[model samples]
Target: MSDYLVRALAFEGSVRAFAVRTTDTVGEAQRRHGTWPTASAALGRSMTAAVMIGAMLKGEDKLTVKVEGNGPIGPMIIDSNAKGEVRGYVTNPQTHFDLNELGKLDVRRAVGTEGALTIVKDLGLRDFFTGQVPIVSGEIAEDFTYYFAASEQVPSSVGLGVLVNPDNTILAAGGFIIQLMPGTDDETITIIEEHLSKMEPVSKMIERGLTPEELLFEILGKENVQLLDTMPVGFECNCSKDRFGSAIISLGESEIRDMIAEDGGAEAHCHFCMEKYNYSVEELESFIDEINS
Candidate 1:
């Protein structure tokens, strides 16, 4: 089935919750980028968390997440919007390492222990928001949790996980974000802590075919949770040949002439999708004419 996300409130609106199943979505990214196991986990977890962040926006509002670490995987970039569309790519898609002590992908080792996680929100009308926080743990989720508390001042518990197959395909990918609101009673907090501590990893739950709603019930308990609307999620990239062409045109008529002279043509590639757009000599000349006109 295609991936999707859910937004709900628990503890009578004192806690906000989000969960998603990203197996298909992350799988597409793996196939497109040829990511290794460790790198897949790193990028998958980041994209899963990003989908939740996108759920918080409305209409044309969107956000970008940059996970720049000192590890082998380098920096990962993810974009998402209120519509549950998310796309991402890692600087080094083939990075991988042996499993950690927990017999899981060594995401921290691939992601590094230093650097920063930065988020930028384009809210339209020149109302933009930027937040940056040091990467406390290269485990993707912890870094985002830290970003929430330090940058957004939101006390949130974030769990993101991705399991890879022997052939380096995505077996399971999912996440959950629980945010505590003001006036949440101490009793509720302790209850949530207990549930999270006893539950299995989020990825395992997803592998077992638990739906997003069930994932929340596992995290916050069915008695205390209130289900909200769900949103369809998928791996979607906005890059197109025309968009790249326009970018080439922006390089100006003189630059187009140089391309036409030296290489005989120009090629543009998108980092997000690894799509290559080749402009023949004729196309280059047309762009020059368009610029001149």
Candidate 2:
């Protein structure tokens, strides 16, 4: 099934929740980057959480999430917009190791415990919003939970997981974020917390074919959840050959001429999707003339 996300409020608006199914989205990233099992799980988890955060924005708002851990997998960078588009990459795509004691992907090893998770939000205003929190757990979901509580001062529970196939493809990937709104009564918070404490992993639910709405129901209790809206999500990049061409021109006539003389053309590769764009000799000549004129 195509990937999608849902936003909802439960417990008479005292709780906010977001859930997403990101199998296809993660698969696309894995295919493009050729990530190994552990690296795929770590990067996929970050991308899953990024898209849910993107849902929190309005038109034209965007955000970037960075996981800079001191592990072999290296730093991970993800960018997302309010329109549910997201793109991400890890510094090292081929990192992997044996499964942990829990018989799950060794994401913690691939994304070491020694760094920080930082978020930069551009709301199209004079100043951007920035939040940073130390990595509490290399298992991204718990780290995100800590980030909201510590950085944003919002009490939240985040559960993100990605199951990778033996061949380095994505099997199932998804997550959920449940937060207690301000002024939420103690009793309501305790009940929601109880359910989350005993709930199965979000990836397991996705593997079982549970929808985003159903996942929220499990977290908030069906009687208390009130579905608000759902949006389709995917791995999307806005880079194009024309955009790269303009960038080449921005380098000035000297740079364009150098490319034509030394390499016979210019080649650009997007970090997000690993898509390559090549400018032929003719194209380079035209750009050089445009810049000179």
Clashes of each: 0, 0
On residues 1-293, what C-alpha lDDT tens digit does candidate 2 reach at each position? 78999999998999999999999999999999999999999999999999999999999999999999998999999999898999999999999999899998899999999999999999999999999999987999999999999999999989998988778889999999998889999999889889988999889999999999999999989999999999999999999999999999899888888999999998999999999999999999999788768
Report lDDT (Cα) of residue 141, candidate 2. 93
Q: For model 1, which pairs clash?
A: none
TM-score of each: 0.99, 0.98
**Which residue segments of model 2 deviate by more than 4 Å?**
none
